[model samples]
Target: MNAWIGTLIALCALALSAATAYVQHRARKRETLGADVTAYFHRTSDFARIKLFDGTVRQAGYHLVIWNHGPAPAERVHLAVADVEGAAVELADCPPDEFPLQRLDKGARYPVPWIPVSDTHRGARRFTVHLRWQDGNGTQERLLPMRRGQTNV
Candidate 1:
């Protein structure tokens, strides 16, 4: 009887250990199946002025960049700039406000055209970039704060 009781207890412990390990394995698998996307400012360039019969001046702005640093691809990706009460930041040559990206592969870089901030808004030093996407797990959203001359991911 003593030997039988010892064997039963050992079996229960083994079963509990196996259950715990399985749960941990599932958590790691779910984590690995998701994609990670990031955003940044690539660089700034000046717009060349055209010299025609009449001189015209054109100003240039900086480019905003989005990158996917993922183990999996991000699907149906969307990007937007968060609205502030009195900010004078504007996007130029940008994608539609609610456009979808079919897929963003891992390690891929996408540079948006330009985001020009009006010189009159000197207090607007930082803005938020709202990112949304779908992965294997589900839909996700991230609010990234971007500073001038700095990269935010």
Candidate 2:
């Protein structure tokens, strides 16, 4: 084979190896993230009438739940809340992993306050909940719609 042709083949092989490594790295990261994350709820309380407390901006404040679904306990399960459009807002963070439900089973539920900072969203015709989190491997996000409340007025 010509020297130039041999060198070209070697360069192509190197490029392929680099690409494969990068892809593997990304997959590993995702797996790690999925392991640590738990399930989150759009609303904490069940579909029952309850008094709404004053929240930060104008919407009624209620406690939302984030359940740990991992087989083993997870610490520092990073969390973030956002609007339907993916705009993030400040939320209370708990370093200590607390499982409201007993045993922290796969489907167990935990309470986390997800106060809608925007009052206008209170009577919102429709809204969504965006959950962002990461455990150790990588990061994952969950989007769920906030259940609408009935209005007498």
Candidate 3:
């Protein structure tokens, strides 16, 4: 093979390797986190307190629950929450590494609350909550309607 051609091939190989690594890293990162919940059961807290804003700035705050239904312990759990209606709503990003919800103790429930800080929470009709956990195991999510009225929270 020509010297120049060999060099070109080597460069292409390097680029391919880099791309592969990046893809793998992202896949692993996603796996460590279980799934995203943008449906039901988001307004209620473990204590049965519901956190919601009455179209005011305070409404930007939201409370959610995280339950561990798996038998094995999860290492790190990250939750990304967003308001469905509010464009660019800021969701809480949590990396619970070395602090997975082991306390749930198999089929136990854990409630977590998050506040929207950015303008992305304006006029939000629905919300999307993403839960990422460690080693990519024990990842699940739930999506619930936004409830108004007297919430326990």
Question: After TM-score superposition, what is the CA distance of residue 152 in candidate 3 from its true location, in Å?
Answer: 11
Candidates by TM-score, descending order: 1, 2, 3
TM-score, each model?
0.72, 0.40, 0.38
lDDT of 3: 0.49
lDDT of 2 by residue, 16-69 (tens): 999999999997766544533344444423433333333222222355666656
Q: On residues 31-131, what C-alpha lDDT tens digit does candidate 3 reach at each position?
A: 54533322234553343333344443343234555666655444455445555553434533333352344333445555554454555553344566555
Candidate 1 clashing pairs, residues 3+ apart or interchain = none
**Which prediction has the highest lDDT against the true structure?**
1
Q: Show model 1 residue runs off by greater than 4 Å.
A: 1-5, 44-61, 83-90, 117-123, 150-153
Ranking by lDDT: 1, 2, 3
